[model samples]
Target: MIELNDVHKHFGPKTVLHGVNLTIPKGESMVVIGGSGTGKSVLLKCILGLMTPDAGTILLDGQDVARAERDAFLARFGMLFQGAALFDSLPVWQNVAFRLLRGSLARPKLEAREIAIEKLRRVGLKPDVADLYPAELSGGMQKRVGLARAIAAEPEIIFFDEPTTGLDPIMAGVINELIREIVVEMGATAMTITHDMSSVRAIADKVAMLHDGIIQWTGPVAEMDASPDPYVDQFIHGRAEGPIEAVR
Candidate 1:
């Protein structure tokens, strides 16, 4: 459903992505794994139209999307950013229904809150939590709220940026399982960028490793562990010595 061909992006003197190419099939979950500063998030921003590439193209469902109408293109996507990215001032329900509360897709305030409550329930959050501000919730609750928000619009494609970051291992596992269940339930195409191997195993149908601004290896999750590529092996196994260098 999504394709990137020779996609390149540069920020002044730094080149982030170089001729990156990959394809995500419809309703499939693809997890992108990489070290810090490897452009995983940048690649996502480029696809989301928050950043324009210096060269090449990105296609969504065969339509050239690199330069598509920004609003139209973004409307089809939902994103759960690192650290939840919620507005502290808004109530949880309002945050979840932010998009639906404005413009053409806007609904009655009562209806929007009802839908938000329903979505929160789907993510295993209670109705009572909907009225709380983001700062009032625990990290896990905030992440669950983020998930509810991402799926509130029932978007065809969803991007998860470091969903497990900053959470305890158990909480991260819970989020991973929830993400997997939601993706399956909604049949949404998912692209997740995370460094957590457990997240990769729980949420990925396929896995791609990015290094030095390009994909170094990609294959089914089952093959990731046994892959012969030194880079993939190093990443999956958390090895201290391999083709992947340790970050300073």
Candidate 2:
């Protein structure tokens, strides 16, 4: 399980996370939802150790992540960045096999390429696409490549940032379903940050709402619509007239 105990973060004079607390059980898909600037990404970054919290503890299976060995600790986690974040210079196979090509999980070049092709197939891409570059694929195909890369190493945990950000609704739905399938098949602990309600309904086993520097509400996906919290209702329903302020 992952636990955050009164975690806090600040940027210069501005506070982002204020005494935040949440827990995600092993093998569950937890999706964080919130408006822009609500610290949704910050929370993910804090957990990933990409950003240091100013206070409190972040524990993964009871061990403090901040104090763990960097390479060894990160080897168990995979990340699918918001923009896919594939290396433009590398082929799709190389991008998917990036983790398998180095560090603790290193494998031979040919073996890595084979593993990459397998993962690509798992995400609905063909082996032929593996030799192409990221710039050569459509946005949806790029997302599939990103998803393939994320699961290539078979990590125990995965983080997805805005998994459906730039796609059309149909493509977004496809990506969402793909993510749900991969997470279940791997039985991996998954944490995603996204504002898309369709994505939430498709991917989240549990949903968390981050607002005002804290987790305002959290529960199973089934409970989200009936949730009494105004923040959650306003956000999920995309209402501009509730507790959340709308800019003029």
Candidate 3:
């Protein structure tokens, strides 16, 4: 459903993505794994139109993303930010319903709240939690809230950024399961960028290793462990040696 062909992006004199190419099929999850400063965020931002690539093309369902209408293009996608990114002052329900309450998806406040509550339930949250502020919730609760918001609009595509970054292992596992289930239940095309190996196993059908500003290796998740690529090996096994140089 999504394709990137020889995509390149640079900052000043530094090139981040060097002719990166990737494909994500419809209704499947693709996880891109990379260490910090490897330009995963840059690749994502370029695809989302947050930043324009210096060259090459990105297509969504065969339509050029760069030439597509911004609002309409964005309407087909949902995002869960790394930080949860809730409105500090709004109640949880309002936060989840933010997109539904404005712009093209606007609905009556009551109806939006009802949909938000339902989405929260899908993410294993109770309706009673809706009235609380983000500050009142635990990290796990906050992540669930963010997940609820991401699916509230029922977008055909979803992007998850470091979905298990800060939570404890158990909670991270919960989040991963929720993500895997939701993507399957909703049949949404998912692209996730994370360094967490647990998340890759739980949420991905296919995995790609990004290094040196390109896709170094990619294959079905089941084959990731046995892949002979040194970069993929170093990353999945958490090896300090190999092709990847650990920063001191």
C-alpha TM-scores of all predictions: 0.97, 0.98, 0.98
lDDT of 3 by residue, 1-248 (tens): 99999999999999999999999999989999999989988888898999999999999999999999999999999888888989999999999999999999999999999999999999999999999999999999999999999999999999998999899999999999999999999999999999999999999999989999999998999999999999999998999999999987
lDDT of 1 by residue, 1-248 (tens): 99999889888888889889999999999999999899999999988988888888889988999557777777789999999999998999999999899965788999999999999999999999999999999999999999999999899999999999999999999999999999999999999999999999999999999998899999999999999889999888888898888965
Model 3 gets an lDDT of: 0.95
- Candidate lDDT scores, in order, read 0.93, 0.95, 0.95
The CA root-mean-square deviation of candidate 3, after full C-alpha superposition on the true structure, stands at 0.9
Span of 10 residues, lowest total lDDT, candidate 1: 66-75
lDDT of 1: 0.93
lDDT (Cα, tens digit) per residue for candidate 2, span 46-143: 99999999999999999999999889888889899899999999999999999999988998999999999999999999899999999999999999
Off by over 4 Å in 3: none
Worst 10 residues of 2 by lDDT: 69-78
Assess the local accuracy of residue 78 in candidate 1 as a C-alpha lDDT between 0 and 100: 92
Instruction: List ranges where model 1 is wrong by over 4 Å.
Output: none
Query: What is candidate 3's TM-score against the reference?
Result: 0.98
